[model samples]
Target: MARVIFLLVAVVSVFQALAAPLHSRAVTSPQCSQFNVYASAAIDEARLSLGSINTGNDIGNARNILQAQLSLLDANTGVTEIADSLLTSAPPAPANASATVVAGLQAALASLNQIFFLADNTTKAAVAAANASMITALDNAQQAVAANCQTTLN
Candidate 1:
């Protein structure tokens, strides 16, 4: 009888130990991680693509890129809404998301010349100023997203 009871206790201990890891992981993996990852990818795209935009394009290529990114923003908000619906939800990453947002904004600034080429020097200065604001916003957003991921947003 003593051997039987000891064996039962050992088996239960092993089962509990295995189950503990699964429970902890489930707790750690917030649904918002999905949103964070996708959002980061979109931001990275903005960062990488910004320099490639041709300021002289009369065909609205830069405009198209901005529109595509804006569409991504819309999708990201949808993901956030779904994540929010869950109990004990993941953190919404306004902090991390701001970096890429700034990138898009910067792209918008550069795109100003494409929209209005012959404007005065003051107008060009305004565009340059807008570009600076975009860069700051984008960096802040990247940091915020990284914080939410807890492992950096990829």
Candidate 2:
């Protein structure tokens, strides 16, 4: 009877050890948490700037808003890096998830590059569309990270 009890205890200990990591990960994923915060802030800034740009404002005002958004997107690079690190450390089940995130980041950067070439109202409209595309790409990337990395957006 004592041998049986000892075996049971050992089995229970093994199970507990296996479960502990999952429980601890949420509390320990600081880089993912930081990434979420930075991503949210950058998204908020982009939204506000996009609002200003869409107000039928003067070209200069629109340009200024776009420039601000570009800066925000640029600043989000660090956060993206953190997200990348987390993903790399523990790749998602779907191996292509990291590639999706990369594609999104590239799309945002491409849109930003195109924005700087705006020369007329038509071009401004195109820039606006590109900005919208960038936001969608960034948001998609964030969602992918949250889903695959077990990240909580708070």
Candidate 3:
């Protein structure tokens, strides 16, 4: 009976040890958390700017907004790159999530690049269409990061 009890306690201890890391990994690292915050803010800004374009108000001002969002996207890419590097040594889940974030950022950047090239004389409908595409790309990036990284938007 003593040997059985000891074996049971040892097994329980092992299980607890195995479970701890899994639970802890659910919370992202500080770098990843920072990336989440920055990325979320960038996405929000992009959406707001795009909405302005869609509403046909301040079309000229929308260019400035897009430029600002472009800058934020560039900055976010740098932040996520750092997070990705740090996460490389982390567990597979976080590392994969970081990769997803990188891909998403790239997509958003590409979409923004296209939107930025729109001629100043472009029709409102055309501009609105482009804005919609950009918004979709941004939304996808946000969703991918939240789903893959287990990141909570602030």
TM-score to true structure, per model = 0.31, 0.33, 0.36
**Mind giving the per-residue lDDT tens digits that candidate 3 earns over 66-145?**
55456445545544544544445433333344445455545545545554444445434544644464455445445545
The C-alpha lDDT values of all candidates are 0.45, 0.51, 0.51
Candidates 1 and 2 compared: the better one by TM-score is 2
Superposition TM-score, candidate 3 onto the true structure = 0.36
- For all candidates, the clash counts are 7, 0, 0
How would you encode candidate 2's per-residue C-alpha lDDT over 30-88 as one tens digit per residue? 55455455454545545454554552544544555555455555535534554554445
Task: Score candidate 2 by TM-score against the native.
Answer: 0.33
Give the TM-score (vs. native) of candidate 1: 0.31
Candidate ranking (lDDT, best to worst): 2, 3, 1
- Count clashing residue pairs in model 1: 7
What is the lDDT for 140 in model 2?
50
How much does each candidate deviate from the true structure in C-alpha RMSD?
Answer: 11.3, 10.8, 11.0
Better structure of 2 and 3 per TM-score: 3
Clashing pairs for predicted structure model 2, backbone only: none
